[model samples]
Target: MIRVSASGVNRPDVLQRKGAYPAPAGASDLPGLEVSGVVEGGDAAAMADAGLHIGQRVVALVSGGGYAQYCAAPAGQCLPAPEGWSDAEAASLPETVFTVWSNVFERGRLQAGETLLIQGGSSGIGVTAIQLAKAAGATVIVTAGSDAKCAACLALGADHAINYRSQDFAAEVLRLTDNRGVDVVLDMVAGDYVEKEVGVLAEDGRLVIIAVQGGVQSAINAGLVLRKRLTITGSTLRARSVAFKSALAKACQAAVWPWIAQGKVKPVLYRTFAAGDAAQAHALMESNAHIGKIVLTWGDV
Candidate 1:
């Protein structure tokens, strides 16, 4: 158990609230998948392996039930806060870090010197991906809805940003990559985007979809997928086994956590609301006007 200090606001929480996305069987019914605070108690072996002890400041990726003063998380899913990070900053890391590590790095197999086209560059996942990819020596290209968002993505180490509302992202990606296209695409919008995304891939490029914000159904040219030998896949961070999350946690502690400590990557905090104002925080997230992340503080801490 963790005495919750802060929790991150995520789209899934909103979806769950609206009864669109239900919690997996045996998971908490409450919304929120991540939190940060002092460790209260848990498995000793798991805690020790995670470099955690009783009363230690740590961040955890919970299965659910993070929007309160206390949350129980898998012991293996916890890690000490990055040096000098605030509770809010630490709180913001788990969901995005875990998602990007699982989908972008693990599933997509994004490597050094590759180019990544992130669909929602100013989003929580997008910001985390941009920083991590850049730190790993990959070129980052992002598409946002407005010029301001484009600028924000650029400032966060993206090589190029396309205002999708005004410019065609596939065309811009081609132009930016000298017509070769990106090596990977982190897509949040599926449906029709699957076809357009397929058009902007280099040979053997990978497309990892982590959300279906646009729509669920899609019609794609299998010929494009076959001819290019592209790989299109996706996964949800939650609903996975504890062992899987534990492995991912270890991987992040090894690969991504160092980047955080070295200042190569940092949390991008947009606004933090008091826990009572969770509705307002969700409103901001749904508005798509805020860049980076929105967090909710649990109490006086």
Candidate 2:
């Protein structure tokens, strides 16, 4: 458990609120998915093994209940907050960071010198993916809904940014890569985007879809899959087992945490609303007007 300081507002939270997604059975029904706070109490043996002590500051990913003044998260899901970051910034890291690390590196197997295309380049997950990919010595191309959002992605170290509204992203990706296509695509918008994502992949390329914001069902060319040896995969983090998430925590602690310490990565917190103003926060998220993360803060936290 933690004395919650701030809570991250993710698209999943919005989906849960509208009944489009539900908390997995035996989990908290509250909306927040991530939090940053001080350790208050927990199972002693578990906390010790997790390298946590009472009063230590940490950020955690949770299934729900992060919006409250206190939240209980599995010990293995907690990570020490990076030094010198504010509550809001730290609050925003766990969900997006965990998702990107698991999907882009673990599932997609992106490696140095590969080219990656990221959908929704200005989202919480998108920004995290861009920096992590670049830091890992991979090239990054991203697609956003507008020019400003595209600029935001570029400024975050994306090698190229496509304004999806002004450009056909698949064509642009091909053109940017000189028709060779990318090695991997970290996708949030699945549905129809899946076909084009498959189209713009090099042989042995991987396409990891983390969300179905566009829709779940998609039609893709089996020939491309066969010829390119493409791998298409997708996952949601909320219902995964504690053992899997614990391993992710260890991976991030070894890899991404050091990057954060070196300033190679930084959390992009677009805004924070008072806990009481959560409705407005959710509205901003659903409007898709923010370029980075949105967080909710508790009283005086």
Candidate 3:
């Protein structure tokens, strides 16, 4: 268990707030995916195997109950918070880090000498993808709603950012790649964008869809899948087996945590609200005005 000091508010939380997504069985009905706090207690043997001790500062990925003052977490899901980082900053790590590592690298098979196109480049997931992909030596192209958001992606080390409001992302991506197309696409907009993503992928490319923000139904050309040997896949982090998540947690700890320690990848937090103002935080997330992660703090510095 953790004495929760801060909670990361994410897109799923917003979706749950609107009655769109439901919490999984045995999870708290409260809306939260990640938290940062002190490890007050847990199964001692599990904690020992995970190298965790009582009073250790940690950021944990949980199925639910992160919004509470205290929450039970699988010991393996808790990672030590980086030294000198605040609760708000540490709270931002788990969900995005785990998602990007599992989807973009594990499933999408993103390589060093490849290009990745990300839809919704200004989102929490988008920012994390840009940094992680760049750190792993991949060229990133992102599509944002505005030029300012595009600039934000560029500043975050994205090789190119397309303003989807003005330019056709598919055409721009094809043009930017000199008609070769990108090696992967990280798409949150799955409906109409799926067809276009199909159009702009290089042979043997991958498409990892984490969310369907643009509606679940998608129409894509089947011929492209056969001709290019494209791999279109997706996964939801919640409802996965503890063994799977524990493995992912170990992966992030081994690969990404070192990046965090060296400053290659930092928490990209846009804002924080008091725990009581969680509704306001959710509102800002829905508005899409923030550039990175949002958090709710319960007085932790």
Candidate 4:
């Protein structure tokens, strides 16, 4: 058995908990995606069955069932915790890193020196995207609802942090880029932002939508897309096949893991609650007041 130290709370967890996102066939009903822990006492076979070992510290992605004393996960999804990192820090990595890598880099094809705009700038995915894009030599812009959130994004290496509530993000983006527009738009707010995102996309720009927090349906401008040759696509990580996720996890391990080990990338944690307080943690995420990730710690870890 493995002892869980910390579990990251995500929107899918909240959705699963509320019955909005139903568990797939043969999946557990528990609500957690990523966790950090140490193996206690289990046979090598059992440990291998769970993709772990006795006394080894690890971080893993779980389909569900993460908010418990002992959680089981496939060994392929687990990675050794970086040396000297806290369980909370290690626990924070998998979900956001996987999501961002799959959506922004793999799908969006964000390239060096490209201009990228990320919505929800203070979110876990937003912070990680900013750092990664900047580190990869891209000019990163972010949009948040509050000035403090904008400042936090700027602090996290965003080139421009726009207050979505105070200004028109598309206009701000246009102004910031001298009307040439951005090369990629990493959007989570899919409602009315669709039109605006298309408006600010440069020639051959890629808009990758990862969430629909505002609303899903929207009117689009086909002419604009055709004129600019923009590509609009979106994806979710949880529903993907294990092989796909494993590939993403492996790619992330190779590209971003070294940076994390060297402190070039750091996990941004907003608050950590106990596992029993998962309901409250979900409530906090819904409030959208957090600047980074909200995690649930198991025991003192």
lDDT (C-alpha, whole model) for all candidates: 0.92, 0.94, 0.93, 0.86
What order do you get sorting by lDDT, best first?
2, 3, 1, 4
For residues 31-62, could you state the per-residue lDDT of candidate 3 as single tens digits?
A: 99999999998898999999999999999999
**For candidate 1, lDDT tens digit of each residue in 171-201?**
8888998899889999999988888999999
Candidate 4 per-residue lDDT, tens place, 126-244, comes to 98899888877899999999999999999988989999999999999999999999999999999999998999999999999999987999888999999999999999887777777
Tens digits of lDDT, candidate 2, 9-126:
9999999999999999989998999999999999999999999999999999998899999999999999999999998899999999999999999999999999999999999999
Candidate 3: where are CA atoms >4 Å away?
Answer: none
How many Å off is the CA of 136 in candidate 1?
A: 0.4
Instruction: Compute the lDDT for candidate 1.
Output: 0.92
- Every model's TM-score: 0.98, 0.99, 0.98, 0.94
Clash count for candidate 4 is 1
Evaluated against the true structure, the overall lDDT of model 3 is 0.93
Error of 1 at 281 (Å): 0.7
Clashes of 2: 0
Clashes of each: 0, 0, 0, 1
Worst 10 residues of 4 by lDDT: 42-51
Off by over 4 Å in 2: none
